[model samples]
Target chain A: MGGYGEVHYTNPTGPGTPPVASLARFVVYLAHSFDDRLALRSELEVEDAKVEGGAAGGEVSLEQAYLDYRLAERLTLRTGLVLPPIGIINETHEPPSFNGVERPGFDHDVIPTTWRELGVGVVGTVPGKVGLAYRVYLVNGIRAEGFSGDQGIRGGRQEGQDASFANPSFTGRLEWAQPGWKVGASFWYGGTADTNSAVGRGAFAAPVTLLSADARYERGPLALRGVVANVSVSDAQAINAAYGQSVGSRIAGGYLEAAYKLLQTLSAFARHERYDTQADVPVGVTRDRSLARRITTLGVTYKPTWNTAFKGDYQLVRNAAGAGEHQVLSLGVGYQF
Target chain B: MQQPAHPAAPPAKVAASIARLFGPGARVDTVSVDTTDVLRVSRADSLLGFAAVGNVLGKDQPITFLVAIDPADRLMDVDILVYREPYGGEVAYEPWRRQFRGKTAADSVRVGKEIRSISGATISVHAVTLGVKRLLAVLTAWHRSGAIR
Candidate 1:
């Protein structure tokens, strides 16, 4: 067993919000090898450090619990609660693995990261030097009733807690990796009705479709990576009408980051992101400009060891509405073992 | 799809790799010490290098690889012969392996220090690094003791 955690101090330059220091996340990872052909992997996570009875202070959840059955060198079958193969950060979000103290806003609003569901999937690499890999899974789908304008389908995630499978979804990713470069594309398609009569009860009712592409290139002291994604809700109007909501019919966003190593243990990076959760609304609903956001961040990370990082960053956050703009200064220390 | 858990590259494959690194007409002879067998490569009367085949645990399974060292004790190349895990195979990429070139046993050979770290492949990278370091140390000791000379 091993674990990782992060502590953060953030000072936001916005009214009514006070500077605070907190333990952002603490996670424990466990894995067991049953045999040469089978293994179990899991992670338990705590957010905000504490969870009191009845008060909204913190949360504890199982992030991943999966069994991997190796059928061949190029193929493996995975079952149980598994993360959907989406953008770069969703599967490899260890604090030391990313540049900023926080994940990119694009991942938060557009991808709804840490996204996982009860599912079964196949993952494998094609034999040869081209370094191609693929993953595909069928999992429980989101619930349309939980969709909202601000968070889009993020709230709809059932997180494998007695999740409804009336509307199943299929998600897949194809990646090509080689020396110094990696590129990937992913897709998630499924229905969200979840047996809700108002949204219909079919597997494809009120469907949610997401497509994304990401790339990374690292050579010597310079590294660069980026991701773009688009999400569409097929029956948004009907669902909104039935639920008295304003869920968007479309959402889109992307971010690009570049890092340059200044020393063996220090690096500087900058990132720019733009996302609109309510990019498009139903024919009769008005879109919320605040749901469209743009953020720019500049940061430096000092890694005294491979599994530890000290990070600090300044961020400029803005919205299309031209209101509620803010800047933040954040410092954090994170580690994995 | 089928892969051996503790695989050794076929003789022809190993020979081809030797020829590529030591040039054509190079001959190979195995020197067994304890349970380990080290390959000695030479072209005519001049010694080219030594190659070691080994496996290291990656996540859950063994990653079999070949590491070649020059007579001067610098790493010439690293080649992954078989990668059993579904993930972390990026450790076998040419660019990652290239980092080992010219590194001697005197170097740290630690991941995230003298050697760069790859995101999402940390475990495999660390395992391979330790494997290479262990092999280098063994080779250095053998040379110093004139056990294979």
Candidate 2:
């Protein structure tokens, strides 16, 4: 019937104070309309401490209830228990859409965004002079360590962990927009569940290939972007590929970003990332691999209304060959209806 | 995690737009839409324009609108004007831009092969279902070719 609640406090770093992150949640967002052509929505979430225990500790399921049928600016046809569309905020969560107070840290720990499952898919647009958009699906993949942004937002849109087997894996994405250059590429195959230990020595072998690419440029006010990724696995666990990271092993990563609004309220951001966790790391030693450093964000957002948002950022972490530099500071507030 | 895009608006002061749901004035006329291609609301209050297809405009970006109506019957009081990308209330909860209200012209034209697709506003419900079926087949062929009304 209704849902919205938030409370966070984590002032622990020293001085023996206490408050290392006490989180609470209550969600039940709804939007029903079976007549305009059927638009049923449901998001039931109640977690007093989800990532802490599991199975929705505070309790309540139905994170997303679906049924949409508008079918044509390009094409449409959705099926229930979904989410895994992957990337860009895992289905556009609306905090001014996105720009650092949150979102974009290797798309959330690496390839996870609005992640979801229980498939049935289609996206639109065609007849291109220069317009091609697509998002194809058939879900339920990813447990990477028991995720719960669904299958969509683990970071940016599927992949950072989870869904190796238990069959039902197939994800495809293709995008190309005109005027302000845009490019996208995605592919995935799910299935894994065989092991002798050491990460599970290729137990259910066959199925681990990932590739990603994105590029953008928007004239006027100024905008530019870039992204790259690659994943390959199932070597009978070469030793967990050599030691441990997850999903068959062998990995790659990339990032580059820029922004400037300067005023309208204010806008300024910066991002620089490098992750190799050994690159896909199963065993390591491509120079000993493991690189997860970052020089991210000096953000800003202060919207009075347009869906409300007030966020701030600063994080300069390191490791992955760079050594520990750890610097953190962040604040956030988001709303949508 | 790559973006430089920051231009919600700047170009078009007015080039071609007429998908009106009404606001500035009110009861005008000239309607016809069907999408895939064929748009021209002629003028009722003119505003409608959309595009956002999957994860709609949040996960990676794909948002555009010229606004006016289709706030999906919020008692119908639409008048947005402009917005390039990034949540205008998730494109005002686009359910294919609320299929452009009421329905007329001997009504009979669901959307995109009848209609069905919205998982997190896949491209803003396919640009409000192809801008309300291309402004209802160009305001029903400009009201059987009368032109204005």
Give the best candidate by TM-score. Answer: 1
TM value for model 2: 0.29
Docking class of 2: incorrect
The number of the candidate with the highest DockQ is 1
Docking outcome class, model 1: acceptable
Task: Go through the candidates in order and give each one's C-alpha lDDT.
Answer: 0.86, 0.46
Separately for all candidates shown, the number of backbone clashes (residues 3 or more apart, or on different chains) is 0, 84
Task: Highest lDDT: give the candidate number.
Answer: 1
* Candidate 2 lDDT over residue span A82-173, tens digit each: 66544444555444545555466576555654356666676554544334567677765543333111111132122323433344567777
Give the C-alpha miss distance for residue A279 in model 1, angstroms. 1.4
Model 1 lDDT tens row, A169-243: 999999987655778999999999887878876788889999999998777789899999999998999889888
- Model 2, residue B141: distance off in Å is 25
What's the lDDT for residue A94 in model 2? 46
**Per-candidate TM-score against the hidden true structure:** 0.88, 0.29
